[model samples]
Target: MQHDFLKNYKHKTKESRRLYSRAVKVFPGGVSHNIRYFEPYPFFVSGAKGKQLSDVDGNKYTDYWMGHWALILGHSPKVVVNALAEQAKNGILYGTVNGVSVELAETIKKLMPRAEMMRFSSTGSEATMYAIRLARARTGRRIVAKAIGGWHGFNTALMQTVNYPFEEEEGLGLVQDEGQFVESIPFNNLDASLKVLETVKDDLACIIIEPVLGGAGCVPPIDGYLQGLEEFAKKNGSLFILDEIVTGFRLSLHGAASIYGLEPDLFTLGKIAGGGMPIGILCGDKDIMSLADPVARADKESLCAIGGGTFSANPMTMTAGLLTLNFLKENKQQVYSKIDRLGRMARKGLTKLFAESGIPCQVTGEGSMFLTHFSKNVVMDATDIANSNRELLKAYHLALMANHGIFFLPTKMAALSFAHEEGDIKKLLEATKKIIIDSKLFKRFA
Candidate 1:
């Protein structure tokens, strides 16, 4: 059978293809970010409104990627946009401490009671990097333990065993032996994690984990997994740092820390916390965060030396975040209710469609984040996902985008926003059914 999906995609996205031809001359892989690049080329989005994206080719898609899972309220949310606009008129950057920054921090503290003190950074990577440094400085240890597939950031220190094969190192230009400072343990496996922690107990500075394995397919931790990890970390004299970059506001206003009743020693947040702007935050107990304070510094050697960038807590991001947080705080029940319903709808619909079509697959996730795997077994961890048929999964994802106009991350992870309604969920399910039948994936699996 002819692959009409690929043909239709190429024809519909002719303009994006032409642009990619020019972009390749400037960018390494014709894309600024690696994830944005796929087999044929990604569609250049002209604009976005709510949960819909209009590509340059005038093809409108129900955007499940949602700005890399940051736009919980959907793209260009009116509240955030209006706040940003008002802030821009006053001034964009002040290069000094501002009132809005304090307000934003206060809002975070109110939402996350454990955030006694907080410091701002420019990106999620910087927040995680600083959190790791603080843990090392406070504990006077050299090693950090992370889950096998957890993606903290691009920082070299936490770059080992992320998304790549578990046996091989994922760091590219990391300093020699830097990977040794970081150890990987199986996620959601208390016994395996404890074993690794026992081995690295002496040198372990921190155990950083994402409550839900965001990039590895939104796999939630087993019942007491997070709490167990925290206990193990404490027992080993290591701090627990929760990376809530993707789940901060997307999962709950207070993040996974609140949902799981986890009291991490340090928390790194970004994504929705930025209100669609570039921002990162590291918040924790006052004593731990004080190590980064210039005024509290006893001496140069005593401080952790966490640096801030030029636009670390600019007014624009502060205003936008403040508005976003306030909106979430006021309309918590309504927003979360809609997103949770949408998530259940999508998962149930996909599972039924795939099963009826005789395709062996499993949908794994919690709340608003989910991903489809081409396997019948339950996905408990990253290894389970890595063992599946990745090529076929990628083909299915491509088919969804090409033929059905349902955009998802090429890794198959998807999310729902408050903007998604019952009708949108129905549309997505119908499109998915059509794609499965048209792509003939069921025949291959059968």
Candidate 2:
């Protein structure tokens, strides 16, 4: 069955195969980002509009991956494209301070007041790296505690335990000592996490975490879990940093921090905040954020040393982001209501469908993000996800792409944007049913 699907995928993606053949010569694995590569070569997208991606092969797909789950308004929303087109006429990158950047920041602050003071950067990795650095600088401590499978990004300092086989090093080129100052805690297990935090409390600079475990799995926090960590960090004199790069504007207009009632000393924002453009925002309390202020510090040692890169606050991103935020702000009730409804529909529908077919699986998610784990056991953490039938899940996602026109970036969570509708969710459920009935892939796990 897998062979048949692979053949079908290969048949449809011949042009993509040719392009990937050339891409391998230029890129490390014929793809820029690692996850973009899949079991068979990934189909190269030619264009995207609304909830669909048009591939080079002339095949169209309902793109649930949604630009790494960024495009909350979906691809090329006319409002953003129109603004960007005019902004492009003016300039793409200013390499200096600009008014649009200030408006964008003000817009963010208006929506998320916790962004009392913020700095723009080119990527979420930089924002998170700077976040921890600011924590250490502020508290005069070296230790950073993150959940065992919490993915903060590829930055060196926080690259402690991102993947399964949590004890092993992430990869070569990252030294062991680089992670000596970092500690791993169990997510959703407050008591155990607190026990881990107790040992390093004295020297702990911060406890950085994602409200919803994004990349490790779409595992939402159990009750009191996040609050417990926040209290611990506060009492231990450690900064509680929320890495909301994936959750910031995606989860809510204010962010997951607001949803959880968290007062993070520092938090990182990306994805939907950028409105499909490249951006990362480090935002927090003004007193703590002031550590990175260059004018006030006046000396290198006094400053925390974080800044927006060359492309940071570029006019294009600023324009798109500002417009997107404004759109969301004006129509937030409608936007979130629709997407969240669709998300719940997908989760409930999929769970029921799998159960009716005698397939034991668990769907984990919150709001508009979700991932399916082929396990009868309750999936509460990354270890549970790792133990689940991942190959089957991957095959299911692959079959969706090959036999159906739905795209999931194989094995990654799916996000419903404002562009996604009830019809799209119905389509997804129907296609999933067809795949399960046609392929009988779930029987292996059953």
Query: What does each candidate score in C-alpha RMSD?
Result: 1.4, 0.9
Q: Candidate 2 has what TM-score? A: 0.99
lDDT by residue for model 1 (10-105), tens: 999999999999999999999877788997888899999999999999998888999889889999999999878888999999999999999999
Would you estimate the TM-scores of all the predictions?
Answer: 0.97, 0.99
Instruction: Show the colliding residue pairs in model 1.
Output: none
lDDT of 1 at 379: 84
lDDT at 220, model 2: 99
Q: Which candidate wins on TM-score?
A: 2
Model 1, C-alpha of 278: deviation from truth (Å): 0.3
Query: How does residue 426 of candidate 1 score in lDDT?
Result: 93
What range of 10 consecutive residues in model 1 has the weakest lDDT sum?
437-446
